[model samples]
Target: MREYIESQLARGRGYFTKEEALAELGLSAEAFQAAIGRVKRKGLLVSPRRGFYLILRPEDRQLGAPDPSRWIDPLMKHLGLDYRISLLRAAAFHGSSHQAAMIFQVIAPKQLPKIAVGRQRVDFLFQTSATFEEANNPAWLSKLKTEAGFAQIAGLELTLLDICRYFHKAAGINGAAQAVHDLGKNANPRILAKAASAYENSAVRRLGYFLERFGHNRQAESLKDFAKKAKSFKALDPAVKPLVAELGLLDEKNPDWMLIINVPVELEA
Candidate 1:
């Protein structure tokens, strides 16, 4: 059975499940478990999560893994869930690499338990399936090939809106602003306005201000146009405390965009 498993892996298969092995090779449950234990001890197999295993190359045995990007699609498929790699991770995929993300962030229709792959972590943020269906568009997602297969990540426009909506999880306004500045050129004006409108007024304002800062006037104007009907102001970073007390900055706010300027920002052309 060990030789059989090795033969299958030698054919270029990089991953497998106990059920697949059992079904294909007709191994009894006890035999399957024993076979798995043996390969694991030999450093040929690693279980990143229960019921799934990655076939490790001899070199990878030292690190005890392959890239987690290779496992994301298979794991999500195993769980039967919809997901989008998002936030700063998405920014990196779209070519605005900021600080390398220590944790891979995923937005799935249902909350998935956290997973650890080698030294890296995969964290899932939950959103209703309904919301995911509504916001998910082909234009808003990109398919990039990974070590094992492909992973779907958010596109630049949607990533900008998402980072602002989940501002606390992303780098603060400064970081978000820098990403916007770096990736702003890749954003499609019409698509950006539409995506921003789908988010709350606060998200719109934050994106609008950042777009303007980076000289994306057309996209910024479109977001501002949509924001005119809004009735309230949202702090630039919702996670931040009031600046007047917390940081001694004046209680200055941008009336046009209805964003509280808790921290001062300077931008140049």
Candidate 2:
């Protein structure tokens, strides 16, 4: 039985309930505790949460805590708010290495709402909106959300916007830039444009500027569209029109800000 548990731990599927362990080990609950204690003494598992045990190898957790998605799902369903992990949290899920990120950012689309778990680093954000922000992308739901009501995952542009809102924070700018760089290869024109559509959004404009410097063409164009959709830049942002004009990117048909936001990078097979 110990050998079998060790095998499952090798596969990176940690997190099992008491009953699960008992049945798997063919032991009573009391025996299960003894077994767990033995495993703990051997340094095979770590308790990321109470009653939850995960086998630990070098870089991955085995029998890790239940998927963050599983934990947040019932809660979100209870609140009836469609949410997803956004910003730094999403970037981390996608595997961009960064430092100093402690809270989980969640988005609902209408307004920014936040919750802080006591003494735990996990945090939550829910956008209070007339309509919950929705992600048609299935990948967003399954892999991006986390365990702590942290579910709202933002599109690339929205993430940039999300980051800008928190730019005043210490890790905000670096975290945001790292995210952009991580996705620098993935920001397709359409997704950027959609995310840029929320133009009353000041931080998004900053992201657009950053994209321009970094050569995100699609994102640049989306930024331009965001400006145009808002019906002019005089009061919204004085620099916007001038910047677009300097780029000579005005297209009555498709006035992208001319960012060329993505540059392709090869991934080896």
lDDT of each: 0.76, 0.50
For residues 139-176, could you state the per-residue lDDT of candidate 2 as single tens digits? Answer: 32434433333344555545555665555431544555
Model 1, 95-124: lDDT tens digits are 776735655788888867887656667778
lDDT of 1: 0.76
Which pairs of residues clash in candidate 1, taking residues 3 or more apart in a chain or in different chains?
none
Candidate 1: misplaced stretches above 4 Å? 4-11, 242-250, 265-269
In model 1, state the lDDT of residue 263. 70
User: Candidate 1 versus the native: TM-score?
Assistant: 0.88
Question: Residue 254: error of model 2 in Å?
Answer: 22
